[model samples]
Target: MTDVRVLIVGGGLAGCTVAKMLEDEGRGGDVLIVDRDPQAPYDRPPLTKAFLGPKDRMVQSPPWAPADVPWLADCAVAVDLLARAVQLASGRVLRAQTLVLAAGSLARDLPGRDNRVLTLRTVSDALRVREIRSGGAGCFLVEGAGPLGMELASTLADDGASVTVVDPASAPMERLLGGALATEVASWAAEAGVRLRLDTKVVHAVPVGDRHAVEAVFSDGEAEAFDCMITAVGSVPAPMMLHGSRGAVGAAVVDDMRRLVDVDGSHFEGVFAVGDLAFHRDADRSLVRSESWTAAKNDGEAVGRQILGLPAAAEAVPYFWTRQFGRMVQVLGAIPLGAEVVPIAVVPKTGGMLYQASIDGSTVGFVGVNAQRLVAMLQMQGGAVAEWVAPEV
Candidate 1:
C-alpha cells in the first residue's frame, strides 16, 4: 500500500480547490487526489448554462500547473478510518496522514429509472443531454422545478423543444425563495412560454414505443407522452465510502472546523468533511449542508487553510444566483420560511426588483431579480436594514 501526506477523494471543485491551495502553499508533493472520472476537473455551473448552447461555448476550468501531483483515476470503494487507508475499485490500497472527504453528490434518481429518463449532474450527463437536443427531440417533460430543472427547461425551450416542468411544490423553488418570490418566478416562467404544472408529480415513467419516448403518469391519473424526460429532483450526498466502518467514519456529522464527527459527537483527528457531504452545525446548533458552488469553494478553502496551520478566513455570507427567463435571480443570506418579504425597490425600466427579507422585525436576507449590483453593494456594506436606503426606481 502506498502512503501520502494527504488524500483527497474527489476531483470536483472542492477537491481540486483544496489541492491547488495546498500546492500553492508549497505542499504539492504531499498531496494525492483520486477521482473516478478520468477527465481533468472542470467548472460545472456552465453545464446548465452556456455549455448547453452554441458549439463555441466551452466551459472548462483553468488547467492546473506542476502536473506532478498524483491524481489517480480510480474510485474509493471503501475506507478504514481507524487505519487511515482507502480501498479503490481497482483493488489498490492507499493510506494518508490526513483524509479529506470531498466525494460530492450524485443526482437524485427519478421514481422510474427508465431508459428514456435522464438527469444532468456531470460532464458526461450534460453531453448526453446535448446530444438528445441535437437529435431534434421535441416535447420535453422536466421533473422537479429546482434551479437545475428551470435552467434545463429554458435551455430545452431555446433549442426549439416544447418544454413542460412539473413539480410537487406549491410553486417553483418555494422552499428556498419563499412564496412571494416563488410566485414571481412562476409568473416569469409562464411568460417565457414554459408550462408549469405546480403541485403535480409524475407517479412513474415507462417507455412507450420504438421512438425512444416516455409516457409519464401524473398523480391525477393523467398520462402524457414526451420525446424525452429530464429529472432534476436535487441530489443526495455521496458518503457511502464512509459507511460500515465500525463508527470510524461519520459522513453525516461535521463540526465548525469541518472535521468529521464521530458517532458520539466527537471530532475525528486528521479526517475532514467538506462540500456536499459535510453537514456543518451552525452557531444556532442547526445542521446545514449547502450544495451551492460558492459554499463548496469556501468549505474547501477554509479546510485547506486549517490544514496548512494558517488562520481561517472569515466566513462570507452565503450567496446563490441563477439565470432564467432572460433575467438574473440572486439571493443573499438564508431567508427562512415565514420571513417577512417586503418589496424594497422595483425598476421596470431596468427590469430590477429588490426585496428585504426579515424575521421578527430583524433583517435576515435579501432577494434580488436582475439587481446584481445592488445586492453586491449591500453584501459588501453589511449592516442592519435600519441604515440602508432603497434606491429610488
Candidate 2:
C-alpha cells in the first residue's frame, strides 16, 4: 500500500482548493488526489453561463489547480476509514494520514428519456449540449426551473434557440429569491423571450424517430415536441465511495473544523468532507447543507488550516450567483424558505434592483439583480447598509 500524508477523493473545486492551499503551505508534496475526470478541478459555473456562445472557449484548465501536483485519473471505489486507506477501481490502495472527501454530486436526469436528455455536470456534458445544438437541435426543453435550468435555458435562448423551461414550482427561483424577487426574475425572463411554464412538470417523455428530438407530455395534459431536452432537476450527494467505509457517510453532520463526523457522533480523526455532498456547520452553529461553490472553496480553506493545526478563520457568508438573460442575480447569506423579501432600491432605467431577505425584521440575506456595485458595497460593509435610495433622473 502506498502511503501519503493526505489523500483527496475528488478533484472538483473543493478538492483542488485543499490541494492548492496545502501547496501554498509547502505541504503539496505530501498530498495525492484521485479522481474520475482527468479534466476536473476546473470551474463549473462557466459550464452553464456564457458557455454555448460561439465566441466562448471552454476553460480546459483553470490556473487555480497546478498540474505539477500529483494526481491520478481514476475512480475511487472504496474507503477504509479505520486505516485511513482508499481503494481505487484500478486495484490500487492508498493510505494517508488524513482523508478528504470532496466527491461533489451526481446530476439527476429523467428516467424515460434517451441519451439526448442531457444533464450539465462536467465540461464534457456542456460540450455534448453544444455539439447537439450545432447539429440543429434548435428547440430546447429545459425541465426544472432551478438555477441550473434557468441558466441553461437563458444560455440557449441567447444563442437563438427556442427555449422552454418547465417546473412544478409557482415561480422561478422561489426557494432563494422568495415571492417578489423571484417574480421579478420571472418577468425579466419572460421579457427576454424565454418561455416559462410554471406549475408544470414532465410526466411522460419519448424520443422522436430521429432519436435527437423528444416529445414530452406535461402534467397539465399538454404535449409538445422539442429538438432537445435537458434535465436540471437537481443533484444529490455522491459519497458512494465512502459508503464502504466504517460509518454513515451521507449524514449532514460535520464539525466547524470541516472534519467528517463518524456514525458514533465523533469526527473521524483527520478525515474531512467538503463540497456538494457534505453538510457543514456554519459560524452560527447551525447545520447548513449548501451546494454553493463558495461554500466548497471555504471548506477547502478551513480543512487545510485544520490539517496544519492553524487557527480557523472567520466563517464567510455563503454566496452564490447566476447570470442569465444578460442579468446577474446574486445571493449573499442564507434565504430561509418562506422568508420575506423587501426591495431596497431600483435603478431608474436599467431595471436593476437590490433586495433584502428578512426573517422577523432582521436582514438574513441580500438579493441583488444587476446591482453589482451596490451589492459589492454592502458586502464590503459586512452586510450592514445605509438606507439606499435610487438616483433620480
Candidate 3:
C-alpha cells in the first residue's frame, strides 16, 4: 500500500467514519482527522429526540481513537490544496498527501428568523433547545414539515408543550410521505395534541415581551403566535471554507464517476471528497443530494476503498431514520418530490402507511413507519419505489 498521508477535514459522522475505516484497514499512519468542534464527534439525530427528552439517550464517541493518531480539534481556516497543506485557526499547518472534504451542511434557517430561533445541528444547539423546552410549558413554532420538524414537534409534545409545524406543503410531509402516510403522521400528531397547519407561510418573527411570536401573514393575511420557535426546515451544504478551492461552492464539488474534485480532475492528484460537502454527480451528472449519517458512512468507506486501489463499491444507498411520538420512521431511498407515489402497507388500527416512489418502472425510494423490517425486505427483493400502496385497512 502506498504511504498516502490523508488529511480529513470535518469531525462529524463523515470524518469519524473515514478515520475509523482507515484505522480498521491498518492504515493509521495515512490518516489525520480535523474538526472545529472541541468535543468529540456525537450523533446529531437524537438531539431532537432522546437527548432533548427527559430521559438519558445521549450517545458519544471520540472523533478519533488511539493517542498516537492526532485529531486537530479546531476549525480549518483554509486549505492549500496545491501544496497539500491545511491551515488551522491556531496557526498550525498540517500536510497530507490527499484531502477529504466532509465539512457537511448547516441548518437551513428561515428568512427573517432570528438567532433566538432554535436549531438542532450541534450538541450545543440541542442543549439550548432542551433547556428552553424543559423550563416550562411553552408554545413552539417549527418552520418546516420535514423529518426534523416532525421529530422536534413530537419531542416537545411529549414534554407537554404545544408545537405548531408550518410548511408550504398542503399536508405534513406530503411531498415525501405522500398523502396516505402524511395523513397517518398528521393523525398521530393530532392524537398527541400536536397541531399541524398545512399550506401556511410565515411572514416574519417578532418578539412579544420576553417571548417571541411569529407573524404568519399568509397569502390571505392570517397571523399566528408562539412563545418559542425552532426551524427544522432543511440543511444546505456548509462549504463556506472552500471558497478559494477551484469551482468549489459552499461545498466541495466532486465528480461522482471520477471521484475527484471539480478542478479538472488533474489539479489535485489522488485527492477525493465524500459526504455532504462533496458535490457529487451520478451517471447523468445529475446532482445526488444526501445528508444522512448512513450516506456519510457509505461515502467515506467508498472513498477509503478507492484510496486503497479497490474497485468502487456500488452506488451508496441513502438510508435515514427519524423518531416522532414514539414511532420509528425510516427512509431507505430518496423519494423524489412530484414523482408518482403509491401506498404499500398500513397496519391494522395504527394508521401507519408505507409509500414508495417509482420513476419509469424503477423503484427509487420508500418511506414508512413501524415497517423497517418490511422495507428492508422489500429493498433486499430489489424493490424500487414503483408505486404507493394504500393501507389495506
Candidate 4:
C-alpha cells in the first residue's frame, strides 16, 4: 500500500509554518511543499522597512524552519481532489492525504495601471523598489495609506526624497484605524515632512519626455502629476485553482474553526484551509477576509492543531501593524460595530496616540501608534480599558 502524505501549496508564511510543524512532529514523511518562487522562504516584513537601510541587508533566517523538509519550487496548477493529488505547472503529480492552500494574494492594480507601476508583495519586488529609489532623489507618489504603501513612503522620505501620498479617503487610515487614530497619523505625516493628498483619485498616467507621470484627477477635479507611482490598495485571494473543485467557495471554503478546505460535514472527514483564504457564509465574512499576514499566521497554527486532532486554539486578538515615518501604528481586536472613538493618550515627544473604540459602553478594540508595548500591556490586564476610565497622564 502507498503511504499517505501531506501536500502544502504556496510556500508563503502559512504553508511554511505548517510544513515546519509537521516535520517537527515526525509527520515529514511524504510531505511536500510546492511554491512558485525558487528562493527559500524569507521574511517579507523586511521587504518594506529593513531594506530601506542605513544598516539593512538580507540578514539571517527567521524563527521557523525544518532544514531537511522536502519542497518543490513550482507553481501549483490544479487540485485533483478526487485523486487526492496536487498538480504542478511542470506536469508533475504528487498524492497526499491532506492538501493545504496558502497561495496568498497579488496586489489589485487600478483599472489603467500596468507593469510601469511597482508592487511590494515579494522579496524581488522589494529589491526592485530599492534599486530604483537608490539611484538618487526621485519624485515618489504612493497610492493608499495601508501598511505596505505607508512603509514605502517612510523609506523614501528618510532617504531625502520628496514623497507625496494620495488616498481617496478623508484621512490617511480611517478604514483600519478609525477616525481618531487616523487624524493622529495624518498629523504625524505632516510633522515628518511627508506630503499628504487626501480624497484624491487617479485619472490617467502617461510617459512624458525622460520621465513618467500620472495625470490624477482628484475627486474635487484638481489634476496632479507624479514621477513614480506605487500602489498598496489591497489584495484578493489567488483562488484560480478552486474554480472547479467540489465543495469550494470562490477561492476557498472553510469549516467552523476556520480551516481552509472542505471536509465531509456528515462524517467529519479530514480537510483544512488557512490564511487569507478561509471564509464562512455568515454575516461577518467581509471583515474576516482582511488577508493580512497576522491573520494568516494565526490560521496556520489553528489548522496545525486540527491536523493533530486537538481542540482548536482560541482565536487571537487579530492584529496588524505598520511602521511609517518612524512611527509604529497597530490595530488590535475587532472594530466594534457603530463604535464611538475616544482619545486615550497622545505623547507629543514620540507622536504616538492611543485611542479606545467602544460600542454600547464596552471597549472592543484599541488603535495605537508607537505603543505596541503599551497595547500588549493593556490587553494583558484583563482588557485594561474595560476596567477603568483613562487616568490623566
Candidate 5:
C-alpha cells in the first residue's frame, strides 16, 4: 500500500489548483492526485463554447513537472474511513493522512434510451459532439435554456446548423438574470437565428430512424424530429466514495469550514470536501453548494491554506460570466428576485450596458453586457452604485 500525507481525488480545476498551491508552498512531495480521466487536466468551460467551433482545438493545462507530484490514473471505488485508506478499481490501496474529495459532478442524462442524443461534460464528450456537428448542416435540438444550452445553440447556429433551444423557464436564464435580462437574451437568440421554445419541457428523446436522428417528445404532446439532440439539463454531484462505521456512505452534508459532516452532524477530522460535491454551510447554518468555476478554485485555495496552518484567504464575492449571441454578460453578487434595477450607463458605440440592482436603497448586485471595466471598478469599491457621467449623445 502506498502512503501519502495528502490524497486528492478528482483532477479537475479544484484538485489541480490545490495541488499547485501546495507545491508552491513547498509541500508537494507529500501529495498524490488520483483521477479517472487518462488525459491531463484541461479547461472545461470551452467544451460548450469555443470548442464547438470547427476551427477550435482542445486546450490542455501543462502537467506538474517541477515538483513531480505523483498522479494515479485510476478510479477510486471505495473509501474505508476506519482504516484511513481508499480502494481503487485496479486493486490498489492508498493510505492517506488527509483526504480531499473534489470528485465534482456528472452531467445529467436525458430520460429514455436514445444513442443519437448526446450530452457535453468532458473533453471526450465535446470531441464526439464536434465530430457529429462537422458532418454538415443539420437540425439540432438543445434541451435546457441555461448557460450551457444557450451557448451550445449559439455555437451550432454559427456553424450553419439549424438550432432550436427548448426550456421550461419563462425565458433563457430566467432564474439567474431575472425578467429584464432574460427578455433581452431571448431577443438576442432570435437575432442570432436560433429558435427559442420557452416554457416548454422535453418529456423524452427516442430514436426516430436509422439515420442517426432523434424525435423529442414534449410535455404538450408535441413531438419534434431533429438530426441531433443534446441535453444540458444540468448536473448532479458525482457518486461519493467514503464509508464510515456510522453508515455515512455518501455524506453530502458539510460544515462551514467545508469539512464533511457525519449523519450525527459531526465533522470528520482530516477530511475535507470541495467543488460541486461540497455542501457549504452559510453563516445562517443553511447548506449551499456553488458549482461555479471560480467558487471551486477559491474553495481549493482556502482549503489548502487551512491545511498548511496559514491564514485563510479572503472570501470571494460570487461572480459568473458567459458569452452568447456575440455578447459578453458578466454578473457579480446575488440579485434578488424583486430587487430594484437601475441603469447606470449605456454605450451604443460599443454596444455596452450596465445596471445596478438594489434592495432597500443598498446596491446588491451588478450586471454588465460588454462593460467589463465598469463592472470591475464597482465590484472593487464594494457597496452602492457610484455616480457616473453619461457619455455625450
Candidate 6:
C-alpha cells in the first residue's frame, strides 16, 4: 500500500488538465496519474483531421505540463470510495486524499467483431489508420455518421481517396443539428465526393477472403466491400473502478461542481469526475452526457479550480464542432430541434450562415456554418451570446 495526495485515474484531456493545474501550483510530486494507454495525455481533436492528413502529430500534454509530471502506466482494477483507495492490476493499493475519475470512454463496436476492423480512439489507432492510408488503402467504409466518422471521411476524401460513410442517423449529426440543417451540411459534403448512407446501420461486418479488405452489410440489405473499414459508432464510458457504492449508479454521476453525487443526492467530499464518463447534472436538473472536446477541457478547468479552492472561471457554454467537407460547423450551447433560429450572417455564394437559436423565447444555442468570425464572437460571449447577436427583425 502506498499513500498519494491526489490520484487521477485516466490520462486523457481531463485528467491531464488537473495534473497540469497541480503542477502549475507546485504540487506535481503529490499527483499520480494511472492510465493503461501508453501515449501521454494529448489533444484529441486533431487525431481525425490534421493528424490523419499531413502532420501525423499527436498533441501530447499541455505546454505548461513539463515532461516530468508523474504518470504510472497501470490499470485501476477496483475502487473503495469510503477509503479513497484504488487497487491497481499489479496488486498495489493506492490510497489518496483526493480522487479524480477522468477515465474517459472507448469506441463502441458494431454488431459483428473482427480485430481487423478499425476504430480510431487512441494515438495507436490513429497511427494504424495512417499507416494503412499511406499503404494506398483508397476505398474506405466509414461506419457511423458521428463527428468522428465524418472527420475521417473528409480527411480521406481530401486525399483523393474514396470514402463511404454509413450511419443509423437520419442525417449527419441529426441529433445535434436537426434534420433540416444536417441535410444541408450533408449536401456540402457531397460536393467533395463523400458518399453518405444515412438512416442505415451495419448489421454485419466480415473480412473478405485473404485480401486486406472488409465487406459490410447495412440494414438496408446493401453490401459494400472496401479496401479498409472503420467504425466510429460512438463510445461507452470506460470501465471505471466504481461499483454503485452508496446508492451510486454504475456511472460517474456528478453535479454542477463536478463532485461525485450519489443517486440519493449525497456528495462524496473529495471525489469528482470529469470528461466523457461524467454524467453531469445541469441547472435545469437534466443529466447531460456530452462527448465534446471543449466540454471535457472545461470540466477539467472547473475541477482543477475546485481542488485548489480557486475561484471558479466564468461558466463556459457547451461547445462542439466538425470540419467535414467544405464547411466548418460549430455548435455552442444546446440547440434542440424546432428551436427558433435567427440568422445573423449568410454567405449567399457558399450557403454559409451563422444563426442564434432559442427555445421558449430565451437564447440557448448558436450554430455557425463557415462563419468563424461570427462564431468566435458568440463563443467568447458564452452565456451572454444572445445579447451580442441581437434577435433579427
> For candidate 3, lDDT tens digit of each residue in 329-382?
877666655656677777555556676676676777777677765666655644
- lDDT by residue (tens digit), candidate 4, 1-393: 222477777777787778777777888765677778776577677777866663235434566655667877887766655456666778777767877777777777787776666777776777666777776537877888766777778888887777888887776766676544566677777776788887776666554436444555566667666667788787776654642334543446676665544344321234466666555444654535656678778777777777767787666666777777777777776664356777688757676667788878887677777776667676565533456344333
135-249 per-residue lDDT for model 1 (tens digits):
7788889998988889888777776679999999887876567655777887887877899998889998989877558998999789999988888988888745664335545
Report lDDT (CA) for all predictions.
0.80, 0.80, 0.69, 0.68, 0.78, 0.80
Task: Give the per-residue lDDT of model 5 (tens digit) for 1-393.
Answer: 988899998888887778888898888888999888887577777788876654344554634322467888988878776566888889999888988888788888755846677888888888878888777538999988988899999888887789999999887876566544776888899998999998888888878767558888888889989988888888888775678768655656676577777767777788888888788766677777787888888888878888888898667777778888898888777665777777788867768898777778776677888887776766676433433232322
Best by TM-score: 1
Q: How many clashing residue pairs appear in each of the predictions shown?
A: 0, 0, 12, 5, 0, 0
Whole-structure CA lDDT of model 6 = 0.80
Runs with alpha carbons beyond 4 Å of true place in candidate 2: 54-56, 243-252, 281-288, 347-351, 383-393
Model 5 segments beyond 4 Å from truth? 53-56, 62-67, 282-286, 382-393
**Model 6, which residues run further than 4 Å from truth?**
53-56, 59-61, 64-67, 244-249, 282-286, 340-342, 347-352, 382-393
Report how far off residue 262 is in candidate 5 (Å): 1.5
Kindly indicate the candidate among 4 and 5 with the higher TM-score: 5
TM-scores, all candidates, are 0.92, 0.92, 0.85, 0.87, 0.91, 0.91
* Local accuracy of candidate 6 as per-residue lDDT tens digits, 100-192: 988899999756758878999988888888888888789998988877888889888998899999888887876676543775768767988
Model 2 earns a TM-score of 0.92
- Give the range of the ten consecutive residues with the poorest summed lDDT in model 6: 384-393
What would you estimate as the lDDT of candidate 3? 0.69
The predicted structure with the larger lDDT, 3 or 5, is 5
